[model samples]
Target: MVELAICSSNFTDQLALLSFKSSINFDPNNVLSNWTQETDFCGWVGVLCSRRRQRVTGLILRSMGLQGTISSHVGNLSFLRVLDLRNNSFHGHLTNEIGRLLRLRLLVLAENNLTGTIPPSFGNATSLKIIALARNYICGRIPTELAQLPKLQIISLSDNYLTGPIPSGLFNILSLSYLLLDANQLNGQLQAFPNNSLQFLDLRFNELSGPIPLLVATNFLISHNKFTEIPLALCNVSSIKILDLSHNSLSGVIPQCLGNFSNVLSVLDLRMNDFHGSIPTSFVEGNKLRSIDLNGNQLEGKVPRSLATCRHLEVLDFGNNNINDTFPYWLETLPELQVLVFQSNKFHGPMGSSKTQLPFPKLRILDLSHNEFSGFLPTTYFKHFKAMTIINETVGLRYMGESYYHDSVTIMIKGLEIELPGILTIFTTIDLSHNKFSGEIPNVIGKLYALRLLNLSHNNLVGNIPSSLGNLCSLESLDLSSNQLSGKIPSQLTSLTFLAVLNFSENHLEGHIPRGNQFETFDNSSYNGNLALCGFPLSKECEDNKTQLHPTPMLHKEDDPTFACGFCWKVVQIGYGCGMVLGLVMGYIMFLIGKPKWFVRIAEGEQQKKGKRSHKGGNRNGGRRK
Candidate 1:
């Protein structure tokens, strides 16, 4: 009778596995090729059976490219503890029968095409510990029944269509640790979270609103919400590490005690808000801060000098503010600093000489545009940017952030305020446009072989375009428009095959525009103000003997339109779109930055009007001056 009972249990599990195999409409990986009657169900791929009962306990088929609905018959495995089908193409509603798995401990079905509401029946799985249903199309409110699970620890339902206020009971779970509900359509005000074991809580990119709740997690990401005001109670959370409350409607002065949290806090992002007040200046020494972003705010006063105490600082942005101050040259002492942005602010005065031998040794991006900075461009600092001069193969490729956080910043690119969701380490640029910097293009800039964009437009810079700039083989966009620069468009510049956006217009530059490589793709707008630049893109033709043209002192170079066709279509086509200048610019940036999603969004944004060739004046306060 015992043997008969074992055979009965084996038959039940075997029938369940067969039902699962039948439900799969597509199995490109042939994962179920061995799910045949000749072989025991225990011997199938991803199947795990116990030694005693020979019943299925685990079924992990992650990234197997499997498609179709999950079979409800899977509930027959009464002893099953894990069911991982993540990173596949499984579609249809989640089988409610999964709730029948009384022994279920982990249920992972993330990164799939599964649609429909989450199965409330999940509440019945008393033994459940973790539920990972992120990166799916699951909709409907989270079941309050989830709170009943005594052992539930992690609930990851991010990147889905889940709507309605988060179940209040879920927050009350004492064992809950990581609760990620970001990138959803969830709404409703949050209740003050009680002190428990919550460690990481992400509610970003949602419609959640109401007064901010008391914080308890170490990594709290609640950006892209409708929350208003930063409560002083938040400053009391000394254990918090990463706090990102950006892109919200928060107002009022930032809690001064936030600066004191430097010892434990690592990431502080509060951009795109209406907070107006002097920045906190109590950053203590031996702090752990790595990124600080306060862009697009109404704050005034000089940058806090105490920020220099952050030894691990990597990214700092203070753009679009009313803060009046000179260059914070002291920040160069930070060895890990990579990105520094101060665009559209009250920062004035010249960037004086570097205090250290290699100032900003790891600086990859420097944007000081739209400010009142005067005097010559920081030439000494350019040579010391060893990080941008060469690619660091040792680090491989990665974004500038910690494992749980990604550093972001906003900088002017192609006249648009582009937001970088995550700054890539290899992405390098230098924007000093709309400033009063007067001098020739620094020759040392050519040493930055990895530099992708350089903008010095709307400045008082004079002298010829540096021939050494040809050494920047990776340069994609070069803007020197509306300047007093005069000289021939260097023929060596034709070597920059990746050059896409060229705006030397409104400059005194004279001679034939380089014809070969990416230069042939640019329109007359690139050389409009120069009036002297003659080439295929321009109306005037270069003379065979005379170096200058009659109408304007145009440039001279051999015309070769053949090489222009070799440029990548993906990049070249972006320039032709009438209202996609933002996408075109962002795409090129994403292509270099190594992010796929941003590259996909490159097909959007405001268009660049080529018909408007009027010169832009240097009026920083008012709107664009023609």
Candidate 2:
């Protein structure tokens, strides 16, 4: 019984020592409640012991959200092979005494708030194979002594503020498969390293600039930097499956040789760059290509026709370019196509044929705004577009009559005005303002229950404002300004509680303005250009309503049709016509005053020839006289 007491005392001391080594606060929850001196350490939470329970073999407390400083007493666990406290909030520097763990194989303290330099003594852990300290506040240069670990396979120090060049000896670890040093202040060109056996390598979002070195990693991500062009060395890595070089200053044409890696290449993102010229046709030829993003560039010409063949393609973003062509008909054939963004391009024509099925049936988001697309969009386009933010505003339209225009027109996007389709339902809408669309406002627009944003400003639309628009409960923005709309302001429009922006200015609207709600909040500028509109904001009241027998000018439709045809129109026409004639006359006068440089040179040449002739004549006459 005396020997048993001694053994228990020794075990308690060992347990105390183990607790001091790790930087962890006691779990308030009962997760580690069993950890006590009375209980065997083997039965403790996150503690593993050997078969005899004489030594702790492993301490795995990953993702336990453990906080507090790591205790140096962790080294007391002499037989510990693995210590994983990853994905925790543990702060403070890693204890330098961790080197005492002679049998340690894996040490991962990633995704923590641990600050301060990595302990140099970590290099002494010769048995260590994997060390991941990524996503931390650890600063200072990577220790060169870490290269001494002969069996190191993975080292991730990404998303940290570690500065200075990467240690050269680190490349000597031929067994290294994954190295992530991105999102750091590390600067310098990538030097040569062992190309074989590497699977994942990311050096992106760093100050490091220069041509990418020849690497054989299967997954390569080097985006959001100052790269000037495509790294030629990257093309040689035929085994590369995922390559991302996005959001950089890379310019020039996209290299066509990328298609050579058709077997392994799956995802390639080169978005948000200065990459100009046309997309190479070879990219579409790759049979295994799944995703390609070339958005936010100056790429011109038509999209490659071969892209349709890439059956597995999911996301294709070609927005914000000078691409001038019709929508790729073959895109509808892609089975897995999900996101197709062609916004701010030069694409024109309707979405699809009236009889044919909707293109991209499974498409979730389709942004085709700021284009030259015209005509009444087929109802089928909105049938499958249950969840989409289609922006067909007419701000980019440069031509007239190309857009859909009928006798009764309603709804406007941008500046181009267009007629709303009869079968259109739900929240979708058409913006066709600023175009040549004419005729009276259509009453059919009230049937669309889902119409949210209706803009018909800056057009030639005529007739009275439709009161039926008040039925749209989901209407948010209603713009009908710069048109020929007349009649009293619809009082029912006050029911639009969701209406945020309402513009009806520059129209021929008259009569007492509606009161309360959005109207009261809006300034007089919204109801401007309507000379007959009288209310609290404009004036006191109409003259006829002020007194019992007050004589007021009869508001005759014939005498004052609310149309201003005064000297302003004649003066504008005369000014425009005279301005054109004056421009021509001034151009001719400037041409007369200015002499061509070539003509001046010819006159100077002639004068020089005459002088030479006189000199020759004088010399010849003197010789003859002699």
Best by TM-score: 1
lDDT per residue (tens digit) for residues 521-572 in model 2: 6667677788877774666476655422212224333222112112223323
**Candidate 2 stretches greater than 4 Å from native:** 1-27, 30-34, 63-65, 168-172, 260-263, 284-286, 348-356, 378-380, 384-626
Q: Which stretches of model 1 miss by more than 4 angstroms?
A: 545-585, 588-626
The TM-score values for the models, in the order shown, are 0.88, 0.65
Candidate 1 clashes: the total is: 8
Q: Give the TM-score of candidate 2.
A: 0.65
Mind giving the per-residue lDDT tens digits that candidate 1 earns over 278-332? 9889999999998889989999999888988989988898889998999999999
lDDT score, residue 199, model 2? 78
